[model samples]
Target: MNAFPPAQALSGRRPAVAVWPWPIALGLLTVFGLLSALLGQHGIWLALSWAALSLPLIVTVICLVRAWSRPSDKGGRS
Candidate 1:
């Protein structure tokens, strides 16, 4: 064990900004994508729909990759 607990700048106790933004943004993108796809058959709406839908998936992939690549800091078993 270390002499002192690892210090964190943000430390989960207080965030620099509210946590709702990302989730709300992702949900809005998904809703917009679905609506555009359902309402518009062709043209810009379809493009927008595809783009909107893809953003959340891309973000998810990025987050997952980052999470998987990093080692856990909260494990200690002897």
Candidate 2:
């Protein structure tokens, strides 16, 4: 077995913020987008809906990239 752990395991690097922010932001965006959509179908409402719908996708991509970049211990411990 390997005696040493990955650099991140030794260094104890962590995300600066908690996981809640993304979901909360996403929820707010969705609500706002829905409200905008309900009120109108053109102008700012359409723009808002598009931006809001894209947020979760953006967050997912960012998280996936981060996970892929981090080194794993190969044993699935991290």
Candidate 3:
């Protein structure tokens, strides 16, 4: 008999094909934000800096909300 339940059985599945595009994009935004801050302190540069910094913050809040709203596994934890 199998030691694990069918749902818990291990398999040699293929790895995920997903890429880190969002992280790379966020990093690029951070660099641009820094450059904008460095080059000047007014008008469009300020707007670009705020937007670049805010994008990552918005992403983080969205991820946190999704994670928090996801249902927890009843059988996995106390």
Clashes of each: 0, 0, 0
Displacement of the residue 50 alpha carbon in candidate 1, Å: 1.2
TM-score against native, each model: 0.67, 0.60, 0.67
Candidate 1 vs candidate 3: the lDDT winner is: 1
Model 2: lDDT equals: 0.69
For model 3 the local lDDT of residue 24 reads 96
- Give the per-residue lDDT of model 3 (tens digit) for 1-78: 113333433343333434778889999999999889789789999999989988999998987776566557333211
lDDT (10s digit) by residue, model 2, range 1-78 = 123345644566533446676679889988887788788789988898888878878888987776677665353324
| Runs in model 3 lying further than 4 Å from the true structure | 1-15, 72-78
lDDT for residue 78 in candidate 2, whole number 0-100: 43
| Candidate 2: residue 40 lDDT (0-100) | 76
Q: Give the Cα error of residue 10 in candidate 2, in Å.
A: 4.7
Cα RMSD for candidate 3? 8.0
Comparing candidate 2 with candidate 3, which one achieves the higher TM-score? Answer: 3
Give per-residue lDDT, candidate 2, residue 77.
Answer: 28
Ranking by lDDT: 1, 3, 2
